[model samples]
Target: MQMMMAGARTRTTTTMMTTTTTTMMMLRRVWIPVLILMMFGITGGEERTWNTEPAYETQGVNVTVIEGKSAILPCSVHDPTSADNKPVKVVWTDQWSTILTFQDNTIIDDERIHVDHAFAREWNLRINRVKYGDQGIYTCQVNTEPVISYTVHLTVVVAPRLSNDGTGGMLEVMEGSKAELVCNATGIPAPTITWFRKTADMGERRESEFCTGTSIVRRYSSFSQRIGEAGQVLVIHNVTRFCGGIYECVAENGVPPSVRREIQVKVKFMPKISLPSKRISTQKFY
Candidate 1:
C-alpha cells in the first residue's frame, strides 16, 4: 500500500512539473515576439530625427560676363564631415542684382536662375543675361549648424556699338561763304569715309574740297552740284555758290548696312542794282 501511494505522489509531482514547463514555454513564445516588435517599433520611431550636418566652410568663387551676355557662379565644399555631408539649403545674393533673385530663385524674379544637383555639396549660380550693373560681388549661404558662406566677383564688359560711334550731324554754310566740309566718323575698325559732289556731269568731282580756285571772287552762276568725299573727313577750304549743294558723308565697314549723313549748303548774297546809288543822289530833282 505504501509503495502504490508513493508511486501516485511521484506521478502527481511529474504532472505538475510538466504543466509548469509547458506554461513557461508558452509564455516565452508569446512574450518574445511581442517584446521584439515593441523594441523595433520604438527604435524606428526614434531613428528619423530631423538632423543635418553643418555646411562645409568655403570661400566665394569668381565669374565673368559680357554686357547682354550670360554668367555662372560655382560654390564647393572642403574638409567635409558628417556635419557637412547632408543636403544643404543654399541662398545666393548679388550686390548689383536688379531683379533681386534670379528666375526660379527667391533672390530675384526673372528667367535666368539655374541650379544643379551638385548643389547638395556645391552651389552653382547661373545668369542667362548679364548687364553692366550686374558686375559685382555675389554671396552664397548654406543653412546648417554652423552656416557656411561664400562670395564671388562678376565682371561685365560691353562692346561698343556702331549706332553710337558712327553717327554725325550736318554742317550749314551760306553760298559764296568761305567754309570747310568736314565728315567725322568714329568706329572700332576706323571706318572708311567718302565724300562726293553731284554735278551736271553725274561723275565724281576732279578736285576735292582742298583744291584752291578763283571761283570765290567771280560771280556764281546756276550750278547745282552734289559734293561727296570718301575718307575720314572731307574739307573744303573756300566755299562758293557752285559749292552750295548736297554734301553726303558715307561710312562703310564692308558690312551689310553703312552709315550716311547728308548736308545742304545754301548760298545767299545781296543782289546788285543796275543804277549806282551815288548817281541817283547826284541827279536830285529833274
Candidate 2:
C-alpha cells in the first residue's frame, strides 16, 4: 500500500511540471508574433507617410515687366528631385547665358537675380531693375537624369518718349494773307496733334481751324489741303484781326500725361493816320 501511494504522488508532480512548461511555450508563440507584427505595422506607416519624391509642374508661358522695375519669372514642380533627400538643384538661363542657380535650396553668386520660393513648391525668380537687355526667352531647368525644363518669354516695356524741334509760337501774319502754324512731335507711337485756341475764361475754343476739322471756304477758295498733318498744320485762309489769339497744340500718345505748346497769333494791318486836336493848350502859352 505505501509503494502505490508514493508512485501516485510522483506521477502528479511530473504532470504539473509538464502542464506549466506547455503553457509557457504557448504564451511565447502568441506574444512574440504579435510584437513582431506591431513593429512592422509601425515601420510601414512611417515609410508611407514620409515619401519625398520629385514632381514636375508648369508655371506660365510668358511674363511682362516694365523697364526700371522688377520682374518675376515663375516655375513649379510636382515633385522636387533630390539625391539623398537634399534640395533639388535649379538653374535659370536665357538664350545667351545663365542668370541664376539654386542648389541645396540656396542661391549662388549671382546678385541681380534670386529665387522666391514658398510652400516648398513655388520656384519663382526675381529680377531686380529690369532693363531692355533682360527681355528674352528664359528657361528654368532642374538637375535630373532626363532634365525637366520650362520656358517663359519676358517682355520689357519702355515708357513713351516725345521730342520736338521747338517751333510754332508767336506767329505774325499780315491781314488778307494766309497764316500757317506747324506742330511737330516725335515719340514711340507717333503722337497725334490737335489744335485749339484759348478763351478769356481759360476755356478751349476750337472750330474750323482744328487740324482734323473739315475744310473751310474763304472768299471762294477752299483751304482743305491747307489743314492736314505733316507734323500737323493749322491754316487761316484770310487772316484778320479777329482771327488772332492763343493757340494750343496738344500732342498725346496714350502716355500718362499729354504734351502741349502754346502759340500766339498777331494780325498786322495798315495803320490809319489821326490828326491831334490842339485844344487851346489850356492856360498860358498864348
Candidate 3:
C-alpha cells in the first residue's frame, strides 16, 4: 500500500480587456518529475527536451601479465543491452581471429577464456595460465556506428633461456688489444648477466705422473662491469697472452634454472726468438 500527498491552493487571476469587458479565468493542476531536471542540456524543467544520442563507449587499455598467471582484456560500453538502432555486439580478438563473442550477457565458451560481464558496463575477457605465446595485441570491438573498438598490448614474461647463436665459443683477440664475448639468452624478466674467467693454471699439480683429486675453480668476479647490455657483452680490457682462459657468462633473473654460457679466450701473440750462438767461418783456419 502507498500514500500520496496533495496540496490544494486557489488563486484568482484577472485580465483587462480593451473595451472594459468582463474577464474569465480557469484553474488547472499539473505534476512533473523532480529527477528529470538534468537531461539533454535542458534547464529549469520547462517541460522541453533535446534529442541526444548515446555515444559508443568501448575502449581498452594495455595489460602486462606474467607467465603462469592470468589476465583480463577489458571492453566496456554504455547501454549495451539497449538495441535501439543497432544491436551492440562485443567481440574479443587477437591479431588473427575472433576469440569470444558477447551477446545478451552470454559468451562463447573456450574453457581458458571466459566472459566477465557481471557489471552492466563491463565486457571483459579473461585468459588463464598465460604464456609467452600469448604476448601480442588484443582487440575488443563493438559493432556500432563507425565500429568502436580498442587495442590492448599483452606482454607475457617468462624465465630466461640461453640461445645457441647468442653464445660464442673459442673467442680470440690480439695481444695489447681488447676481447669481447657475447652471451645471448632469451626469456622473461630478460636476464641480466655477469661474467667470470677461469685460468688455465687452475688444475691440480700431479706428483706421480697423474692427478688424483679433482680441482675446482671457486673464484669468480662480477666481470669488469662494462657489459654493453645488448647481448650482455663480456669484455676483457687490454688483452694479453695471460688473459687467455675460460670466460663464462652467467645470466640470471631470480627465475628457476639460470642460464650459463662459456667461451674460451685465446690471446694470440708473437713467439719470442731465442737462437744459439752462430759458428763463424773461422773453422776453416783450424
Q: Give the TM-score of candidate 2.
A: 0.52
lDDT of 2 by residue, 1-286 (tens): 9999999999999999999999998887666545533432332343322244456577558787767789988888766746467566566667774435443232335466777877576678788898878889888876554456788899876554444546546788898889888776754355778666554431222433432333332322212112343356777777766567666677776644567777888879888799998876557664
Candidate 3: C-alpha lDDT: 0.58
lDDT pick, better of 1 and 2: 2
In terms of TM-score, which candidate is strongest?
Answer: 2
Question: lDDT score, residue 108, model 1?
Answer: 38
* Tens digit of per-residue lDDT, candidate 1, span 111-222: 6666543534555677777777667888765543344557788876554333432334445665455656556665434567756453333232334243332222111242
Off by over 4 Å in 1: 1-62, 79-84, 96-107, 117-121, 144-146, 162-286
Model 2 residue 14 distance off true place after TM-score fit, in angstroms: 99
- TM for candidate 1 is 0.39
Error of 2 at 117 (Å): 2.7
Q: Model 1's lDDT to the true fold?
A: 0.54
